[model samples]
Target chain A: MLSPLLSSSIKYYLCFMQTVIIGSGNVAYHLAKAFVLNRIPLAQIFGRNENELSKISGELNIPYSTETLQKADLYIICVSDHSVEDVSGTITTKDCLVAHTSGSLPKEILKGDYRKASFYPLQTFSKSKALDYSKIPFFIEAENEEDRKILFEIASKISDNVMESTHEKRKYIHLTAVFACNFVNHLFARAKEISDLQVIPFDYFLPLIDETVQKIHEIDPKSAQTGPAVRNDTRVLQLHEQLLQGESLEIYKTMNLSIKKMYQLP
Target chain B: MLSPLLSSSIKYYLCFMQTVIIGSGNVAYHLAKAFVLNRIPLAQIFGRNENELSKISGELNIPYSTETLQKADLYIICVSDHSVEDVSGTITTKDCLVAHTSGSLPKEILKGDYRKASFYPLQTFSKSKALDYSKIPFFIEAENEEDRKILFEIASKISDNVMESTHEKRKYIHLTAVFACNFVNHLFARAKEISDLQVIPFDYFLPLIDETVQKIHEIDPKSAQTGPAVRNDTRVLQLHEQLLQGESLEIYKTMNLSIKKMYQLP
Candidate 1:
């Protein structure tokens, strides 16, 4: 522990780091908004899409540019994974820390001689949706402890949950998100497709979908599990499989088999 | 369209129909609680599980019995699908409407001289969890219009969403539930398994899980889909596939293939 005066000065130094965001997409928009809401001033938002960038700048009241990059203590590259290297290379600011906001890519992928870091917010972002920023978990990684502390302090201003994670752990985090978020949504689409066959309103399934998610918060999903696959109900399983065809049939059979195998049901 | 005097009497008749619930499981517990909360009088709660029944009775102040079931105008069998027929047979009340609260089973499965029906509440229930009964969709099917109206009125008291669904449609509804609820929960469990290996706290993933579900309420899940599968990022896909083993790996591959095929991606 340090003296009270020294700790306050150190906190001021951590919070005063000038930051610039590079992108006009969902993640960039949400991040900029969160920072603005939290009173963390941004130097500029730089992106190629002029129309989208202008919209964000207008809504967030943050300065935007399409060509010239702003000089800042930290630059968060929020562009696509493929574009991260190219966008990072365009930054000519020397001795400044640069971080990319991506789940799958490592910090080393940033093509810059300056400090490299990752400022990953592990949640899905949509431009139109209002998020509770405090609940979102931010995973920070940096080449050195000084930059890591900077990123973590900035993140801590907007979110309650923040941690420093390695590139290896972040890879699995992204993979786990694929299974939990993306695959789960696809299943919802498939379920809607089936319900639509009989003109059953897809809205009817929303409560069950909601409760399924709510259950796991309290109960371990394995113990909370229910339905045909877990029960090994052959009669109902045969009926459901016959109702599906082509890719739907494939998914139904595979998921049922997986669930049965997981539960050790023969 | 009817006169107010006759219509009020008809409404009175519908509301006055006495309801008896059978069984001592999640469905039974939730339905009983919902009915009591809505001020809908239950004649008695009948079930063989005396311990669970006493707990429900003690909390709800509703009469419970392991052997004798009170005579009522309507009997809603809320037992397991396998025990539904046998429990419905146990009801010796003459000329009363009998219904089983099941998604998959047909109303005709009830073996009795009395009228048969289905009063299925489409939701996942747990004894420990509190639910917004108004959001749960009630699918009612009866052999006659009078019984249907009675159930529709009773269900309407507890839920805002009540619909007359056919037994055929109910099967599809049940099957849709398996895909949307059970299989989706299984994916959440798998996600936890992966995250647990990296020693990542599962709480961090809850916000993502919530947003995935929240996105669909506004956007169709197909258009809302994200991740390596939808992005067609073969590198990330390969890495994720390599991280998983046995059933998890099989599920990962099958789900990715299904998502790719649905998107018409190579």
Candidate 2:
């Protein structure tokens, strides 16, 4: 038994782990491309969208189909949060490792008697954009030790940043991402709206936006905080409040209040 | 008359523009350093803080004094927004071009007969951090065309991004920056707060944060947005909401609502 397990593990590591990617979205496309680029042989790409699946299939030179799914060493379900469970149920390969690439969902959400796991890459993905996979952080979770090691080793091939994170921790991770990435982008959109009102070209604010992100890399965000809210400059804050209306005003007020509260400023 | 003016302008450009920087703060230190780096001569560094003034003087090989401010072709009031008018009153040089480095305040606020102008560099500055000045946007405003040209030329020496903006436009620019830089940093702070609660290392989120900012450079932030709020995934949103409290909860809900409103998602 030990000889057979060791032999298979060695073979998996030596050449490439046979993998099948489910769903044809941003995450699916990017992950498939990364695997191929790293010389990891994908057995097939399975998804409901024929057009998207074909694009991934052609781009990565892998077989893809909408109908039948193939058995592989691992199956990565890269569907939406709502569809992760349903997609995970379609994989019929018993005892095979099945992982869902979700930041919020737990490994238990993947139905089946198979070894369940999560191989979450912590970055926003767009189908058209290429990314440096090596820099992206991949959070891995598995029910058992051996599967965890397997997932870790595979993730390590594409990323320098990989770690074992539990579902509880990952929920917070996803929450933080919403605040840092999603909410941050919303603020950018709001800034663009305000700039549009004044006919100030949105490009003018890009440098400041870039610098804001750049600053936090070297310093903590709390320490990196600036502007009227942090400074408690009532005059400037009031002036800004007057210029905005409706949802913009509400956002401006709420954000300012939050900032002030964070720093314990009056 | 044109020859004299042209000769003086040529001389000003050839050697260096004699400039005095008032108020030794982040803006003062950065602007002063940028001027010296671009070979623009600093006549004096004047401010109330002897330690900061001396540091700038010693580092830049320029004179420093809290006692008397010197006369120069241009006197830049790099004081805080509240102190700009007061600092402008101290510069005794009549008819010399006077400028304040302020984003929100108008050029007319420089309370003197001297040619009033605003030389606002749209970036968040830290005393210890070195920045690429060429990437920073300098918004120039002046009472006269010649002064505007002078400010533009001076700004162009250190930065490639320079624009002539009115007081009206600068106010909105400043307001938009509050959303883009200041508010964005606050969100990062809040994200860090949530991540800390779960003992998830903040560094893990840095890649996601960096990618979020990088994505916006290529696509609009509206298009770049992702997460539960954008997707309107009620399950994940509710789960995240349950974990946060107080200002964090308030921020999460408000930001999500704003995003939903922006995208017109239910």
Interface RMSD of each: 1.1, 0.9
Off by over 4 Å in 2: A1-17, B1-17
Please, what are the lDDT tens digits per residue for candidate 2 over residues A159-204? Answer: 9999989998888888899898889988998899899888888888
Give lDDT tens digits, candidate 1, residues B1-266.
Answer: 34577556657976677778999999999999999999988878999999999999999999999988888888989888878888888878888999899899999999888999999999988898889999999999988766777788789989999999998999999988988999999999888988998888888899999989999999988888877788788878887777889888888888888899989999
C-alpha TM-scores of all predictions: 0.94, 0.95
Fnat: each model in turn: 0.83, 0.88
True contact recovery of candidate 1: 0.83
Report the CA-based lDDT of candidate 1 relative to the real structure.
0.88
Q: What CAPRI class is candidate 1?
A: medium
Error of 2 at A126 (Å): 0.7
| lDDT score for candidate 2 against the true structure | 0.87
lDDT of 1 by residue, A108-174 (tens): 9888779999999999887877889999999999987677777877899999999989899999899
**Chain A of candidate 1: what's the TM-score?**
0.95
Tell me the TM-score of model 1. Answer: 0.94
Q: What is the interface RMSD of candidate 1, in Å?
A: 1.1
What TM-score between 0 and 1 does chain B of candidate 2 receive? 0.95
